[model samples]
Target: MPKLETRLTRTFNLQYPILSAPMAFAAGGRLAAAVSRKGGLGIIGGGYGDPAWLEEQFALAQGVPVGVGFITWSLRKSPSMLTDVLKHRPVAVMLSFGDPRPFVDEIRAAGARIICQCQNMGHIMDAADIGADVIVAQGSEAGGHGAVRGTMTLVPEAADYIRATAPDSILVAAGGIADGRGLAAALMLGAEGVLMGTRFWASSDSLVHDGHRAALLEADGDGTIRTQVADIARQIAWPIEFTARIRQNAFTRRWHGHEDALRKEAATVGPIYRKGFAEGDAEQTGVFFGEAAGLIHSIESVDTLIEQINQQALDCLAGPATRLTSDRP
Candidate 1:
């Protein structure tokens, strides 16, 4: 990829205006550090506030310039874990799901940049009100949990919202952003950069199972599913308003709209789901991802993927396709 620069790179002090989303356990220290080393920001997913796992990954990072993210509600339960991690002084602290206001003071007191992943304009405003250093507009196409809004409309709306309310705050677009086209489109929508999950999940450094990665490579965008009760029934305890997006499989097909049934089957289905995770069964183990999965045909190194995406964006923007053809009488 050719050399490219954007506001996000300068504002966030990132080598590339690209970011690897905190994909729960999928994006562990190795993956996060790899992306950070490869000129992008890598945030270790402090998913559901697992202090032990967080500590283990932080150790694995070993002083790399990476940030850490947490699902806000879970962090509330384990307040001390956040305090402990902050002692290391991560580059940034990203908070998604639930209100991050209560913890913003502590995060800022540690001299860490604050990145709030917002699900809507209201959330964006709330993050700005809390004096967030940066706002990541996470549209519904994002993997794992999110609200109900497509990336195309949500990104631009969030951008416009921030531009009007907090012009100085940097905005990054998330959800279904995989290739150069996605990156360029985000910039057009008023984002300074892009935060990616599914694409990175398929990378060499990600903890995603090899078989699962292979399955994602074989699948297309249309294969993804967006559901709510699946995660709730599994006891993940995501906020009632947020939902998850994953690859559609037998499980989703059977329970997608059947929230009532999922609630009823939770007792029996939960055990099977856990078994699938241990056995690495793709049919049962959820393949968490976004629509961008269609653009990802192969699993490559983090460096290669990041470089290609940046280069592709530059090439497309410099090309003539962006110009309009007009004929006048």
Candidate 2:
């Protein structure tokens, strides 16, 4: 009913400048298709390059035009997975947490737009240097793995850098953006759109465990902390510079400040962690989300959530001008 168009909308041919983040193990085919069907682009998370899982999710999308995202560093271990995904003719390919340059040519050759998710100015410059079609400025407030920069400062700075260097590359904002207020703020900060993770992770269509979703609803912004505990427990070997943000629980309380200790006990703890994760034990497993957890109170369908956000953003954008008058003192 309400529309706000920007470079991102035009470039992606979408009704709204919204893209659902490809959260690992959570954003699945159903979630991706739901977002896409609602006029926003959705990306299935191809975390750690599981060929079988990727194929299954693609099949579940049921012919909907959706994209796929990968943990770039993990993708390096099985570069052939990219080749396989390209065969599906994904509308876009998103690379995050590693150098996207190595796979740029192949993605472009496949006729899919390239979206590089960058954590800092260097990453932004690198993405632009390689002629990325879309650049997402992802801040530390984002769920899962990310570097230390905050979204507020990183986004406008990224916008300026992209404009001066690669004018054709459009910018999107990520990290702690869950609702229409955040979408409106991103537009003001020079982002053409917002790429959301935690919000979508809580959507009914997402693949998050019921316990994890329950934890998300109960969490406030302060309840989350950045740590290496989950990665250590899962033995993910993420780059040292990036840490994951997850809800603080008994597991984190015990392991957050003791990385070496966690490593020492990983053999004993890892299996327990895996079991907890599989069983949806929120206290023992990592409830991955961001500060936006505080903003989200309910789990709704992707289409309903998108429609509400779009209309709320339109209202917020128009309200400031209408409520302000020269006669006001």
Candidate 3:
């Protein structure tokens, strides 16, 4: 594989400029460790903050250097979770879906890099203001919760903002990025690296259910829809601006546009949604994934996935120069 180095790699001492999104419930210790072992950074999803689950995942990492990510708004409910997790000495701590300022000082004091996932220019500015070590420009095309803005435009905009403001902060692109093509495109868009979710969610190392994995393989970009139905059904109480991009299923079909109705019926429907998710009923529950689902066809180990993505990105980055030279002759 060709060498692909960037500020992110240098700052993190990583061999690849790739980081796995800390997808809630799915990105566990095994997956994060596998990615770290494979040269990329893996982030265990700390999702709604079950202290026991978080501890268990960390144990699964077994001392490998890995980070942990959390839904920022959710993290507010359990401030102590951050203090507790800091004890494990994570390489980094990623915050998304809410203001990161409150916890920035603490994360920094703990000697861990602070990564803030931003959904728009406003969010980017806020992250920069808080002195985030890394800022991920998360587009709406990403799986899980995010606001409007496409990756292509958002990344460059964030890059410009960071250059003019927080020069020390590393910019990473996320959403609709599944393979080497996306990685190459991200770098060209002025980001130092890429943050992937759906691709890794489908990998063998991930804690994804078999049913969800099968659905992901069969899905196309069009199969995903950004909707509040999943959160509503699960009673997560995400902010108004954010919506989750998940595979459209029977449950979504019935509630996508009828969020108010779903909310009203949460007492009745919430249990069903939770049951479906627990049972791995693909059609009945939300299969959280992004537009990149179309790009994934198989479930491979994290090692194979990262190796292929790195090589392919290097090839893609070099293709234009090779073709231009050939044409000039």
Model 2 agreement with the true structure over 1-329: per-residue lDDT tens digits: 86999988888889999999999899889999999999999999999888999999999999899999999999999999999999999999999999998899999999999999999999999999999999999999998889999999999999999999999999999999998888988999999999999999999999999999999888888989999999999888999989999999999998999999999999999999999988889899788999999888888899889988898788878977653221112
lDDT score, candidate 3, position 185: 90
Per-residue lDDT of candidate 1, residues 211-326 (tens digit): 77887877888888878755846767667888888888877877778878788778888888877765656777577888888888888999889887877787677877743221
Model 3 misplaced regions, further than 4 Å: 320-329
**Ranking 1 against 3 by TM-score, winner:** 3
Residue clash pairs of candidate 1: none
lDDT of each: 0.84, 0.92, 0.91
Task: Score residue 57 of candidate 3 by CA lDDT.
Answer: 97
Count residue pairs with overlapping backbones in model 3: 0
For residues 1-329, what per-residue lDDT tens digits would candidate 3 score against the true structure? 56699999999999999999999989999999999998889999999999999999999999999999989999999999999999999999999989998898899999999999999999999999998999999988998888899999999999999999999999999999988888989999999999999999999999999989999988888999999899888888889999899998898899988988988999999898888888889988899999998888888899988888887788788876542211011
Better of 2 and 3 by lDDT: 2
Q: Compute the lDDT for candidate 1.
A: 0.84
When summed lDDT is taken over every stretch of 10 residues in candidate 1, the lowest stretch is 320-329
TM-score of each: 0.94, 0.97, 0.96
